[model samples]
Target: MSEFLRSRRARLRPRDVGLPEYGGRRRVPGLRREELAQLAGVSVAYYIRLEQGRGRNVSSAVLDAIATALRLTSAERDHLMHLARPVSRRLRPVARPQRVRPALQQLIDTMENVPAYVIGRRLDIIGWNRLARALLGDFAALPPEHRNLAWQVFLDPSARALYEDWDAKAADVVGYLRRDAGRNPHDPDMASLIGELSLGSPEFRRLWAAHDVQDKGFGGKVLHHPLAGRLVLAYETLTLPADPDQQVITYHAEPGSPSAAALRLLASGQEKTTERTLSCSEA
Candidate 1:
């Protein structure tokens, strides 16, 4: 984890990150120890000790300040918190997939107004409703190995075109997955996913080395649609209490907003299209 921290810190630039460049030739890529310490409100010695792995037990408050100074996303902040502490000795093995309980499936089906889907800790899309399918499209239709959020974001060309703010979105995906990797470092699936993406996508490779992590949570997203042009939506992620590693993400648009109107229009058309396809199959 110290290696991860050092690697991420080295990738950031002083001027680009709002730190003043000291007038001198430097051997490092990002802000100097003193600069980072100043930005994070810590002493240069303390920051150096932490980076060098001499200071292992860091407080959450200090970590939060450091994460803020780094301009880390929510997911990245969470990962930093996890890494500041030593790994747990009693960590459990990864759980196997099972049918999403009938009740949960029903709950998803009942969310008529919002688009929602359940994803496992490994970022696998385990279950989702028709609206989710319509919004995200056939990416979920791919094989399980290819259905991961990170894979879709980096490997799929369509994802780059779909997101209005593609770079930000890509960072979020990488950060979230990094957090997941830190939490379950022993999980072979997590390792394999990371390896595949690292090998396949240059963008993924670059971001992965940054060691940024984030807490999965609610946020705003801007999407460029093939049919609707552009839409902005608020997203919320809720962890299932019963299912330890499963989370439901829902998308909503403000009432009377063009995005909301467009969602309604899309929903109606999607329902009609489903009916027509079913009818054609029956005939």
Candidate 2:
């Protein structure tokens, strides 16, 4: 929580928050702790304790005020609330394996040309359709432990080539992981994945430290698919209300576009196979 607040604070400047910038040397970047406290209508000492992770009875109203003062987005505000809430020390039960319902699997399968898949906690690729396999590579061939999108983005050499803006894709993965971490603080498996990524990729380590939190609902992505060539696809992410940890993400191109025709060709298996299988091993 302290790190998150500090990072957000460092991103803002006096001009951004409507404060006068005096021409003089300042010891720290962004607004000082006192300045933020004053803006939020809180005592500097109280704010200090909160940043130090010492506040035990912080109120929602105070949190809202602080969030507003910091100019936090909706997703970031939710992350902040989750972080500020007290954690339970009770031992967590073993996490059950996530599964896609047969009906839901069938639904995605029926969307002929769309690339759709179901991802669970920590971005695990639990289920996917044939088109998704063609577009994103065969998930079934990967070891169950390596079926996570975050792992592939950082460690898989092919993934870097697969996306035109690899840095943005990598950052999105880290942001989702950060938000999930805030919600599931004691998840052992999540901790293990994060540890592995931190050790494997310097880029992952840098983004993880930024503490950027986001919920990827919908976005446009440019991909250079080996089989379909260059494609511009818009993706939609739907979270299951009954199972908040699960999400269905689907990618589709605009109707009558070249990308759409490419999708049809790929779906029909008319194009010769040239894409290599996705592997989790670092190359």
Candidate 3:
């Protein structure tokens, strides 16, 4: 909570909230404790306590006032509340395998023309359809640890080659992991994953320290696939109602686009290969 609050406070500037800039340069990024105290109608010492992890029994009014002073969005404010009022949650290993629902599997199977997959809390790829396997690499062939999205994005050669903008997407994946870490501070699995990633990739550490948070939504992506060459696609990520921790991300190329033509060719190749394998097994 302290770290998150400090990060949030550090992002705001004095001039942002109508504070007159003094001629002398100020040390803090945002309002200092004293300035925030004045804005939030609280004692400077009391606000210091909260920021420094010394405050207990913090009142809702103070929180509301601080939120107003910070101009936090609804989601950020809710995240702040969760950080302040966290409950003990069950711990799960970051590499723990997740099961996909039969219905979801069936749904993805039916959408043979589209690439689709399921991802779990740790951003681990839990399940994928055949088209997804072609587009995103064969997740089933990877070790469980290597199946995680962030891990693959950072560590796998194929992943780096597949993305047109590897660095941006890699940062986004790290940001998601950072947000999850904030929410589950006590989880040993998360701690272990962070430690490993920090040791392995300096880029991951740099991104993790940035403390960015992004909610899942629709987006467009371009990938340079070995089989399909340059392909552009739009994707929508939908969180499962039954299991909020799980999400289904589906990708589609616009009709009559070059990407769509590439996808069709890829699908045809995969189908022919499948038929050949089946015939060999029967023979």
Candidate 4:
């Protein structure tokens, strides 16, 4: 956490970040340690100790103050809290991939009219029913290693071709991933995914450097499905309270909109295909 704080602080520049510099030879860009302490309403000595990891206990109010002073994004604020406190021993691990829990799967299955999916904290598409598959294309068909949203956006040619506005989609994916990375800095899988994408995709690298972060909740997407063509979908992402690391994302179109009608048609076609496949396998 200290390493992360120091690194983030080092990246900011004084004038660029609206900090007035006192006349002196500066050792680095961004606010000096004392200046940052002043801005965050903390003692310079205390801030130094915190940054050096000499102290780990920090109140939420102080953390919030520091976050504001640093202009930390929503993701960064969450990361700060996580790092400052250890996870409770009583808390159980949520949503393992061995099997999508039946209840969650049923919830997704019941959303027959909406394109919905379950995603893990690392942005892995754990499961999706037929409607989601229809709207999102063959995300579930990819190997587990390639099931990551960031990987699909940057590494998969089909995903790139499928989205009508690829660049905006790519930014959103990276931004979301950036937020996750900050929150779970200790996650090796997340680290490996970012490392791999940074090495492989220049576009991902560029967007990542922008330091954008987003909390996962709700957003809008424009998808160009091969069968349904152009559709603007409003999506709501709900975190499963019982499962900390899992979330359900559902897509909806405006009432009586062409996009809504197209989604219905696509869902019907998908159902027919599924029925035929199941029948053949059973036979």
Best-performing candidate as measured by lDDT: 2
The sequence of per-residue lDDT tens digits that candidate 2 reaches over residues 39-92 is 899999999999999998799999999999999999999999999994665755
Number of backbone-clashing residue pairs for each candidate, in the order shown: 6, 0, 0, 0
TM-score of each: 0.77, 0.92, 0.90, 0.82
What value does the lDDT take at residue 60 in candidate 4? 91
* Residue pairs in candidate 2 whose N, alpha carbon or C atoms collide under 3 angstroms: none
Model 1 regions more than 4 Å off: 7-26, 29-77, 84-91, 277-283
lDDT scores of the candidates, listed in order:
0.80, 0.91, 0.81, 0.81
**Cα lDDT for residue 283, candidate 1:** 100
- Pick the winner on TM-score between candidates 1 and 4: 4
* Rank list by lDDT: 2, 3, 4, 1
> Weakest 10 consecutive residues, lDDT, candidate 1?
91-100
RMSD of each: 4.1, 5.3, 2.7, 3.5
Candidate 3 residue lDDT tens string, 60-170 = 888888888888766567666666766555443454347998988999988888999998866778989989998899888888877788888877777778999988788
Error of 4 at 199 (Å): 1.8
| Model 4 residue pairs with clashes | none
